[model samples]
Target: MSKATSPVRFKAKLLRPAKPANAAWTFLLVPKAASAKLPSRGQVGVEGTLEGASFSAVLEPDGQGSHWLKVDNKLREAAAVDAGDTVALEVTPSGTMPEPTVPAELRKALAAAPEANAVWADITPAARHDWIAWITSAKREDTRTRRIANACDMLATGKRRVCCFDRSGMYGKGLSAPEAM
Candidate 1:
């Protein structure tokens, strides 16, 4: 049988506490269809504006058929979200492409290259940001090739812009082999 898939959208109210609490809550959003499967951990993404600050979170299932989200500090501080302020949740089947595995040799080369580090440190943060965004955004082979080439050129001069090295270090120590990809 084919797997069932559909976008789920819902409105949720933020519940505040009577006192400042470090704990977060697990509020539920009923799926639009009874047969609609709730997203598993790392299968959900959120985008919204709260108290004039916008943020996004990737929801990860806690394995109990419940979802948990880690909100950025900006959203938490701006909203002053308490036990009862209403928040909205919209979940859709993400069309995200799987990230390609950057070869370990390339990662090690970048890490060990003193020139690369010097160049990377010289670049502005915005340039680094753009480089990272470009590399991670591409899912196609040609795009990946272009990004890698661009990165190589940047790193050859010891200039780290953004994508000069795999900052996440998919090949480095302590990472599970499965998670490396």
Candidate 2:
């Protein structure tokens, strides 16, 4: 359900990653009470503005059980937001995450591995997104191919996700697809 900005809005200083373990620079303050009225962090489908820049994002739970939004580099640039700046944030439940696109190779691999395909169908959209992100994050053609192959192997054997994917976006210390060199 869509919501007006007023009720869901808050002003908080952007914060840096708190420690070595928290590597993502993100918004420091979230209206925790208001967020409870929205979807859970796991299903953070929300459309809102950061300092007036419009974006779609997910709010996920942190170790302390509070919701946090990761403002990626692109969003920070577009909004001119930086760590330590106080900015207005408006978040409303956008529902579920947009489905991640499966690479053609991953699709082909899944087709050849019926077991993986079956498991794929049973997973939540978020779980599927994890696999897709891991596969698509690969910058090199060969790397992407390997991730796809690995995805099939894991899924075929009933693995819900690639082991150690930093799905939390925390320190990003997981099985992330290699970025372009």
Candidate 3:
């Protein structure tokens, strides 16, 4: 739903990756019940309040038919909460597709291929987002690299969308929220 009449509200405990983790990412598991109100079981663009602090984020699918929000360091600081803290969240679908960030490797590949870059520039943000999602959903580095190459190849040939990608994770099991601590 675009600009929901009432925001979906929930409370979830922030969790960190198990010890020995290399990154500083934190997460909040959106309740399955709350996630059902979201527009897609896939990546959803949301504008929300976390512990009363305003923010926007893209919720990622949790692989078991739910979703999770990746709480970055900035939001955690602004919200003044940390791992192990249960906090309130109020969110509504952002009303527009959020632009996906391009990974470095893919950006480099696109830059080196003029035809692909032109096609990439011509595609809609949603199309670009799908390409990014498909590439990043690869669990293995080799698979990611291959997907990037394939994406560029397809783009160079003027393909506007990623073919056969299950953005919602309903058909393919390729995407999932990272393992929680």
Candidate 4:
């Protein structure tokens, strides 16, 4: 894996959701221009600094051809910032794609289906990531259950990639970063 030529730097105001009065996260939007410079429009691993506090994170697609950074309590405390503050951000896509975590439901389904499990084990990390993303992107429980079943069926049939999955959320509005109020 190789590093990007240079880090993409930008500044964005941190914002918190209003509806979920108990929302635990604050986030900042990456400018479209800066986001376009990253390796992928989808979820991308980035190692960078937020207000001089070094960190690594996965930038989530905003479903509008850009990305957003989730700022948790730890990072906020480290950076000494809060919602409504504009912060400096410099990020470069990680040299390697971080392995995406397999959702428990998918894991159980895969384990029960040996054919799909074999195919799942044989696929590349990126392919697996796409499959997992496609499954977890579902907005409803029923949809998610259906996707898992469909995924197993597809995998059992030797399908290596999720068909018509919009990883970047550019064409399909299936994935997006959480909205900030």
lDDT of 2 by residue, 1-181 (tens): 4433343777777777644454555555466566556644333567888888998875654433345667777888889978878888877666567665677888789999999999998888788877876676565889888888888888989999777765544454332211211
Q: Order of candidates by lDDT, top first?
A: 3, 4, 2, 1
Per-residue lDDT of 31 in model 2: 60
Runs off by more than 4 Å, candidate 4: 1-4, 18-21
Cα lDDT tens digits, model 1, 1-181, are 2222554445555433322345343233333341134433223444445444555544433233334444444566676764445655544444432232345534554577666656655665434444544564465767766775667677766655553333223322211111100
* Residue-pair clashes, model 2: 1
Show model 1 residue runs off by greater than 4 Å.
1-7, 11-42, 46-53, 77-80, 97-181
Report how far off residue 44 is in candidate 3 (Å). Answer: 1.0
How many angstroms is residue 6 displaced in model 3 relative to the true structure, after the best TM-score fit? 2.9
User: Residue 19: error of model 2 in Å?
Assistant: 5.7
Residue range 37-97, candidate 3, lDDT tens digits: 8878878888999999999888988777889888889999999999999999999988666
Clashing pairs in 2: 45-94
The better-scoring model by TM-score among 2 and 3 is 3
After aligning candidate 1 to the native by TM-score, how far in Å is the CA of 84 from where it should be?
4.2
Q: Write down the lDDT of every candidate, Cα atoms only.
A: 0.45, 0.68, 0.87, 0.87
Global lDDT of model 4? 0.87
* CA shift of 123, model 2, Å: 4.2
